[model samples]
Target: MTTKINRHLTWQRMCACMATCAMAIVVACPIAGFASVQTASADDTANTVSTIIVRDGMLSRYTQLGGAQGILRQPLENEHPTANGGAEQRFQGGTLFWNPSLRGSYLVRDGMLSRYTQLGGPAGRLGLPCADELAVPGGASQVFQGGTLFWNPSLRGAYLVRDGMLSKYAAARYEQGPYGLPVSDEYAWNGGARQDFQYGSMFWNVSDWWKYSSQGPYPNLAGVSNLNVAVSIASQRVYIRDGERVLYTMITSTGINDWTPRGTYRINGRGPSFYNRNEAMGARNWVRFIGNFLFHSVPIDSSGNYIVSEAWKLGQPASHGCIRLTVADSQWFYNAIPDGTLVSIW
Candidate 1:
């Protein structure tokens, strides 16, 4: 009986050892290999075993196991108020879809989201009912419309706003005086105010003694005659038969060479008797016209005659192309001649 009992005890010990060896082999194998075996297990009891064990974070575990590849793990509930409110779902190939309560589902390609319906709501406001762009008026100032600011088809100037009033600068306001009429003191003082005057009526402000033509009523001299008798270089003598008779006749030196031009000229300027020491002589009331050329009196010698000294004469056409006359003759010419009187030369 004792022997039989010992045999039963040894058999029990052997069975226990065999069970421990099987447990050790299972623990020694790699966890990945063991997991694969568990997943591939065909037995209904082994199939219930999960390969991935859930640990601390349940949400993280759910994402790793339950989420589809290339898709959003959770629904997007956070967005700006201006943005369309919805839960955004992501799919493979980076596609996004919006699911809203009021609006139907929409597909988002790239970064833009477009509605699927053409209903009379926010979608209609996009293009059909709303303008492509909006414009705001600048300020309380003037608003320019279809035409130009100062919409005159022909006229041009600034359209200004001053003291809350609209005004224009134009060429029809402060007009110029008529021909032969004196310019007003106001217009002459304030030249800027005359910019809007009549175009042809304006005349330049010349010296006090200067006068413009009246017979021709033009700036240029044409068939006009002198108010008094005048001499020409070509004739070398006063031509008084055409108008007033000569009071006296005197010998005068005319311009030499072609330096003196022949034309109908006006006595534009005059001055009192002055000495030109460079020519070593005294002149009276030297009349200047057509550049530096002048009509003046030259010094005479002791014989009571005009001196034609070599220094006074440049031989290459002397008198600097001016008419040299006696002092008495020059004084008479100056007092008798008017500013705009025509002086003819052949």
Candidate 2:
């Protein structure tokens, strides 16, 4: 009876050892369906050590993006709460903001990351990035919840435009338009807001928005008007047109210091000759368009002798504040251009 009882005890011990070994094997082998291990941290204790499992969602995304070796480098923080209950994790290269309901996580990095943060990150008008940055023709671009951000190699960095400003930009064909890409965020100016672009700026007020092109201030004809005079400061040329038809083109000189005002003005007065004692010079066939501003011939001396050197400055900027035309051109202008004709200078 004693032998039989000893044998029974040995068998029970063997069965218990087998069950323990099986459990250990199950734990050691990784589960096939679960995400691969991303990162592990350990907590030290006197009698036990516990492992923190960092996996799934964001972790999975991080792993796919090359993790420690990718542009994002290493994770700087564990996943944390953000606006709208979303989660975000900071990395050496950039940041990953995750919104599970919105499908998945998206990355914002480099110059774009800085700009996004400046605009208030996910809490700002831009919200979260909807997708990864895309390679555009000239640079890169990324779309967001509220609007889009664009980057160009030729520009200082990335910039964003949204709401009404974005609509205006789109209407002008974005980068292809006269404005090109945005150079600045919408900022307060005068009484409203202003957003600058590559070529021009857009101003906003309580009632409406308008574009101020850097090329020059042009009046909105809507349809062609009867007569308008346009001046090109850069080209140093004057265009006299009738409802879009080129009536005449004349070489001219503008303010050397860019003192000539840029805008649409009316021909308010005309004179046969006038002299500025302060400037010690005079001109003939003068037409006043605005305050102390005029279109006249090259400078003449008190002896009424044409200053040959001043006339040589045609097709360039050399005047104090007036538009200088040639002797014959000014003569024709004084006689032909009537009062109330619009003059646009840039």
Candidate 3:
């Protein structure tokens, strides 16, 4: 017990000595060194005096943005002339990109900055930022990289638009077109490039997007291939597609006992036709595909009574080899589908 007490006293004396030495060093150090150390502290939010200088419009704009206490914090770099004869100033959390074309410098941050880096900043296609993020119809946007990164505070991120797609979006009055602002970057699709937008997607398979050409339902179809129909026996659902874009989807039932042949076919004809072994007028609404595979309604007896057991088996394979759809869906398919809609099963 005496040894432990002595050891504790010795440790306390050592700690006091260490603290005194630290205080002595601080007292001996020059004031400039201490200021330098404080400037580089971990709290980037610290509002230390910055020696960085700004002038003219840059200074005016910096003050307007609330100087040191504002969102921009402190200026990290000096203002420099851009290739477009404009000026730019980088801040702690955002950047002020200004061109003679604008009233004041626009601030950019968040998803806008990340996308700017990805698009290669000023060195890439989008040259200097002509404007800061400003309000538009649905949300806000900033013009950069010769395009715009649109942001909505309520939405998670911004959408991108530039080049031909931007032209289309503008032509459609900005989000007024079938293809809205691009939610995704351009990617390889169907031997060409494609981008997704808010309202719908656009395809740039090196095709004439501005041609106002009509393919399927789009007066401005932008994809490489027309999205078609697909039926999965396993999941028992139907999908109407335009490339990867699913126009419509519905739950369906397929054949049981290997009766549903798995192959791709088209809508060769429509109904007022017989449904399987039920005979002509056997199905009130139906369509035929493959040799015998059909998209038909729930079974109706000769007196038009709903077959209860067959109705209960709607999502399961109950038909001989036919695909079953609800009555309204079957009726719509029979009445609406043109003669040559594509159909595939597996």
TM-score: the better of candidates 2 and 3: 2
For candidate 2, write residues 101-155 as lDDT tens digits: 6768889998888889998988888887888888765667888888989886676
Clashing pairs in 1: 273-284, 273-285
Please report the candidate that would top TM-score against the real structure: 2
Model 2, CA-based lDDT:
0.70
Task: Name model 1 segments beyond 4 Å from true.
Answer: 1-230, 240-249, 275-282, 300-318
For model 2, what is the alpha-carbon lDDT of residue 108? 92
What is the C-alpha RMSD, rounded to one decimal, of candidate 3?
18.0
lDDT of 3: 0.60
Q: How accurate is candidate 1 locally (lDDT)?
A: 0.34
lDDT of 1 by residue, 209-291 (tens): 01111111212223335354365554344332225543333334566665666676777788875555575555556787556
After superposition, the stretches of candidate 2 with alpha carbons farther than 4 Å from their true spots are: 1-54, 205-346
Span of 10 residues, lowest total lDDT, candidate 2 = 22-31
**Would you list the C-alpha lDDT of every candidate in the order shown?**
0.34, 0.70, 0.60
- What is the lDDT, from 0 to 100, of the residue 164 in candidate 3? 76
Error of 3 at 173 (Å): 2.5
